[model samples]
Target: MQYRHLTAYALLSLSIGLSACSTAPLNLPAPHATETQSLLHLEDQFHLNNLATHFPDPLAITPEMKAFVKQHVPESLPEVGRLRYLTEALRNPRTFGISYHSGLTLTAAETFEQKHGNCISLTVLFIALAKEAKLNAWVNEVVENQDQELLADNRIAVYKHINAVVQLPNKQVVVDFSDLGDAYLRPQQRIPETRAAAQYYSNRGVDMLGENQLGLAYQYFKRALQLDTGTSYIWGNLGTLLNRMELYTEAEIAFREAYSLDNNDHTALGNLERLYLNSGKKSEAKQIRQVIVRRQLNNPYWHYGIAKQAFEEGKTEDALRSALRAIRLDNSEYRFYYFAAQIYRELGDRDNYHKFGIKAAMMRKAAQDAE
Candidate 1:
């Protein structure tokens, strides 16, 4: 999960939790429920007697899942053939043919039975099946280093994609069930199975919170923090829930914990700012707003959005300036180059237009070929 400016809207991450498993067997580490710090007073406040104890394991392989793999991936086939057949069967319309939806975060078994789920559910299912086939599989957080759309409720949904990766002796295959292709974020972060399971719980908490199931949401968030105490987004999510429950003191702590874990992800900071404002701490809120502005100024995607808007408004010079700034900040995205080419074309600078256009086309082709 990633964070963005919070004043404009609440920021939430829709991360799919795909945990890692070794080739020998799927012996994922158990959650360190005792060491968690984010959910300090919430257990007593919400009367969470069992807390993280009773929730079903999101990655538990059901009989149906095992049966599907056994029938489609024959033991007679070589390792490579088995892997190929498994992937094909998962994607084949005549087989599992899992589809995408942004609803509940389901377990691997539930995803298989339902045949539809969001990215998180799909990736979870993939890792579970890969484990059943005795393959090295894990979850990776693919950061696009980009901003996402704002929902109707004025929430900023900055999505960090989750995908399953299967490793072989000489090669690694990323089964990007999200279908993001090669145009994914760079510098992937591998999640431990325990933390990945925490992501599942956190995602489910988000879903429950959406449906106004506050008590259940609290339970899910508690389980998530217990599993992985380190994730800032989960902390931030719990903070959001706490704030909703009017547990302001604990909410403050959770938000602070989140910010301390990852200052780069500004969700905590944004929430903090809101909390300050609500408590009549205008000076603190002002200071946080300044910090947010400074961070936004440094973001290349923010500048790119500005450039696009300027171009649409026919402010050619202004668009060019912002586009160039965006390129200077990050030269990896092809869309920036393509936009620069358009600006140059509008300015009648034929040589530079062709230069940027060619560069954009080459970059785009390279990305596709890499896939």
Candidate 2:
């Protein structure tokens, strides 16, 4: 985990776009906001000896997916209301549709074949079905802050929540796989399709990096940034990757760009703080840490973050208590379920682990069912 050599010669920062008329990334012009840009070519980032598996195509819509929708949905469904009918149709198990599969990025085709996936994968699945039914559909991402997950294998997955948004002539409906009703909720900001695709690829890259597949991960991250460079976390991920390679200068720049893009990105702030602390910038490091402490005091997720730290420290009881406290602060957050599962595992309470696992599954299902 050597880090201290990555410095961008220059950077091309892409502007964030969110409007009623969002455009396609393919048609998007290369952003040249600066005189020089970092070498963003895929070849520069990838040099794998074994490049057997290619990246999954995000826009893929297979015939199987379309035909499945046709077989279940009535052909005579009025064009304007197809989205609503399909939504109801998905809720029935007899209709031969979606189930929940956790982890990784699966394409619509893979999800359709597998019959289940996590919210991100499920949303892609649902949106594909909606599009086949002739309804306008796209992935909708909710604005998230201080919502990050520390996954297995030293990998961190920043949460950029996704749900299906189907546009109707009369109304628009949101299809969520993690229904958090009347719970503490955040206002959603729908991302363009390309941005959504970028998120998927970025997450897949995270998993790949966890596997130590640096070459493939680099490719994935490049593609993600190419699709939507405005994503702060994606840049942060790139910075983290560079850090692992000991590209500290480049990593610092990347992290700062991430924080600049989104002030709430404590991950970037934390990383920057570490860099500054190591570089003898004690005051700068402490200032960032203080900001985080002040913010976390009011953030409901503060307890969960503490719980994660406790779990890592091998303090079972403290972890469990903190995890529970997080739930007490906000019961609707699914991350708490994950923490509780970890605690139960540590306590060797298989029954409680299974119970909480089932509870989490059901909560996700209720969201998918939009119940």
Superposed on all Cα atoms, the candidates' RMSDs to the truth, in angstroms, are 9.7, 11.4
* lDDT (C-alpha) at residue 220 in model 2: 79
- Candidate 1 on 276-363: residue-level lDDT in tens? 7899988776666666566656778767867876788789999999899989988988878998999999999999999999998899
Q: Give each model's whole-structure lDDT.
A: 0.71, 0.65
TM-score of 2: 0.68
How far is 283's C-alpha from truth in model 2 (Å)? 4.5
Model 1 whole-model lDDT (C-alpha atoms): 0.71
**TM-score per model over all chains:** 0.79, 0.68
**Residue 138: error of model 2 in Å?**
2.3
**For residues 172-234, could you state the per-residue lDDT of candidate 2 as single tens digits?**
666677644412134676778788778778877777777888777777787888888787778
- Best by the lDDT measure: 1
